[model samples]
Target: MTRADYVMPSNSELEAATPPLWSIEEQRPRISAVDLFCGVGGLTHGLVQGGIRVGAGVDIDPACRYPFESNNSATFIEKDVNELSGADLLQHFAPGDLKLLAGCAPCQPFSTYSRSGRSKKRGLDWQLVLGFGQLVQELKPELVTMENVPQLADHAVFQDFLGHLDGYHVWHSVVECSAIGVPQSRRRLVLLASKLGSDGLRLDTGDYGKRTVRETISELPPIMAGEQHAGDPLHTSSTLSPLNMRRIKASRPGGTWRDWEPELRAACHRKESGASYPSVYGRMEWDAIAPTITTQCFGYGNGRFGHPEQDRAISLREAAMLQTFPADYKFVRSGEKIQFSRLGRLIGNAVPVRLGEVIAKTLTSHVKMIFG
Candidate 1:
């Protein structure tokens, strides 16, 4: 399915104070999939949007259960990918249907940011990626895909993943999100492998043009720092300290904390060592692409997460939208209190739905060329 063909919540439905009741029509698609490490179902939602049927999503985080199941027509299996066997995943697919496995492993350990940190605790997380490859080797799925930080492209684990695809036609490259209609300036490594044929399938990186911050979030009703929009609870912004409030007020869009008065600048900002990290305490430019959304994006002090016009950091909903989630994609179930850290991690760690859609589209085209 194309973007125009994909259904979305109506404006009235989206504007409702609460999510609509969960319902999805039963489907028996020829192309079926199971999403591993499917945090909050961003990639699964995109697959569904691209006209693929996803049987279920697997992730260890129980917090992901609600959103993953609520937003899409798929079951949520709370299990670690490392512990899941190929047989465990195979049961979700129908016999004779094309099987697809998507695993976007946690990228923190392989991210450039993590490498710059002093901590070595995250070093072992890259091993989790190997489990995905193990499953692909055992299950011998008809198709497989993975997405991660571009830095991971050079990692040994990635080479090991390619090693698993002995009989499959594989292709991978770093895809820029702005090229695919996502509103953020994020780049990710994308891999696609197919056992269908020697047709030499490759991804199609279409020119959708750049999406800007103003184009993406300009229509939403504004809320101030520490306040939630009465109409939508998820539209709440993080409470800023008085010092941050003053600092943001002095800041201009696209400008850093250097714009602050000498008294308002953080001690770190005044220090020579802080000059390299200019993106911190910065506001996004309204008409330009947004900075990459990080897990701590709701905090104004985190990266360039400050709102272009508002005096607060972007809300969780704004971050989700920037990540290409639908306006009304429910993260928290109704009546559940929104937790900023948990929700932010789910949103930031998610594959941008637009990027996922592009991946799905590429798969769809390849499947048609091979099977039709």
Candidate 2:
């Protein structure tokens, strides 16, 4: 029989595809996954899109339950990963031929913000990383995957974590997230470990064309300062102070603070240290990838988050889109007022759904090669 003629959609149209998982129509075994630290189910959604049967997701934040469950056909279990046993997680999986345990522990400790050598204490964020390895060792799932900040692989904690997998073959790389279709330029460390004695796939950046910021959000309905788009409440932008509004109006896309009029310049911008952080208060370049979308991305003062032509910061919907969340992905329950801080954390902390799809595709291919 000849192979069916099929042309995959471009990166820009990835989310528009119905049912998310683009290749499940073919013969493939059931490979279920349990997402640990599944904030708002970004990884779970993308994994589902890549054809994995995600039975459930676990996270400490109870708020994630609605969005996680609403968007994907998966249960969201509210609990600290530390409190949950691998056996408990494994129970979510059916007697499938293959099971996967996936998670991306919090990356704050290894983030550039915390790299000033200022901390004398190690918090649960670090502990969570170690705990991830512990669970993997305990459960010994046939396939394993994790995604985190690129700096994580350099940490001594990461080294010790690797030691736990004595016999598992590991394949890992520092992934340039934007290259893999995420609309923002973010780098992450991704690891795939397998007890199957074969190396798993590492996603290829060259496989697809890059998406641009304009393509991701330029079509989103406009919103004024402190106003939500009537079309979609989630498209609400943060209200700017009088001075900030003027500053954004004077700003040019991709331009820095130096481009602003002297009268609108903030006191900090005049300082020598501020030159290193030029992207703050800057408008995004429409044709390029966005700067990394952080938890505070809804604020104009955070990174280059200003709208390219509008006189306001990027809205919640825009930020989510840059993270490659589907246009219709729900972040709030019915009648729930969208909280900026909570939504920001959810969108920023999420693994870009597209990147998750890349990981899922990699895992699915390896499993099929070895099992089918």
lDDT of 1 by residue, 153-230 (tens): 887878988998988888888888888889999988899998776453666777788999999998999999999887
* C-alpha-based local distance difference test score of model 1: 0.84
TM accuracy, model 2: 0.90
Taking the candidates one at a time, how many backbone clashes does each contain?
A: 0, 1
TM-score of 1: 0.89
Which one wins on lDDT? 1
lDDT of each: 0.84, 0.83
lDDT of 2: 0.83
Clashing pairs in 1: none
Work out the TM-score per prediction. Answer: 0.89, 0.90
* Model 2 clash tally, residue pairs: 1
True lDDT of residue 132, candidate 2: 83
